[model samples]
Structures are given as C-alpha cells and as structure tokens.
Target: MSHTVTDDRQQQTHTPVALIGLAWTLVGVPLAYGLYNTVKAASALFSG
Candidate 1:
C-alpha cells in the first residue's frame, strides 16, 4: 500500500468560530450604526 504525507506549511491553522464572530461584531456594529445615521441625516438634507 502507498501512503500520503502532508507538511505543516501546507496546512492552515484554525481560528475559533466565536472569536471570528466577536471580531466582526465589534467592527461591524459601529460601522453599520454610523452608516445608518449618516443616511438618515443626508435624507433629511435632500428631502427638505
């Protein structure tokens, strides 16, 4: 039988799902909030 082997450099390390989610949430929430408020203010400017 033949065997296959892989090297560490060929493999990628795994990051935890919760950590990824937390990082996105930290950045995404404020970004979305600021965009929302900016849109609301700009709408008022054009609607008048």
Candidate 2:
C-alpha cells in the first residue's frame, strides 16, 4: 500500500492594487505632512 500526497491548498491571496494605493495614501498623507512641516521649520533657521 502506498500513500498519496495531494496539494489540497488554496492559491495565495493578494491585496488589490486600489486597496494598496488607498493604504499607501492613508500612510503617506501624514508622513508627507510631517516631512513638510520639518522642512518648513528647518528653512526658517537659514532664512533669518
């Protein structure tokens, strides 16, 4: 008697592009805002 092996597995799932873009946007907005604020504040030192 021999045992049989089977892959009875589902395919890998992935997040949609639109969802990924939205997620990135959600994260990037605050990151960009923080960076902008940092730059603006730093520029003040040299502009004076």
lDDT of 2 by residue, 1-47 (tens): 99999999979999899999999999999999999999999999889
> Which runs in model 1 stand beyond 4 Å of their true positions?
1-8
lDDT of 1 by residue, 1-24 (tens): 999886657667999999999999
Q: Could you tell me the lDDT of residue 32 within candidate 1? A: 100
How much lDDT does each candidate structure score? Answer: 0.95, 0.96
Please report, as a residue range, the 10-residue window in candidate 1 with the lowest summed lDDT: 4-13
User: Cα lDDT for residue 44, model 1?
Assistant: 96
Query: With candidate 1 superimposed using the best TM-score fit, by how many Å does residue 35's alpha carbon deviate from the native?
Result: 0.4
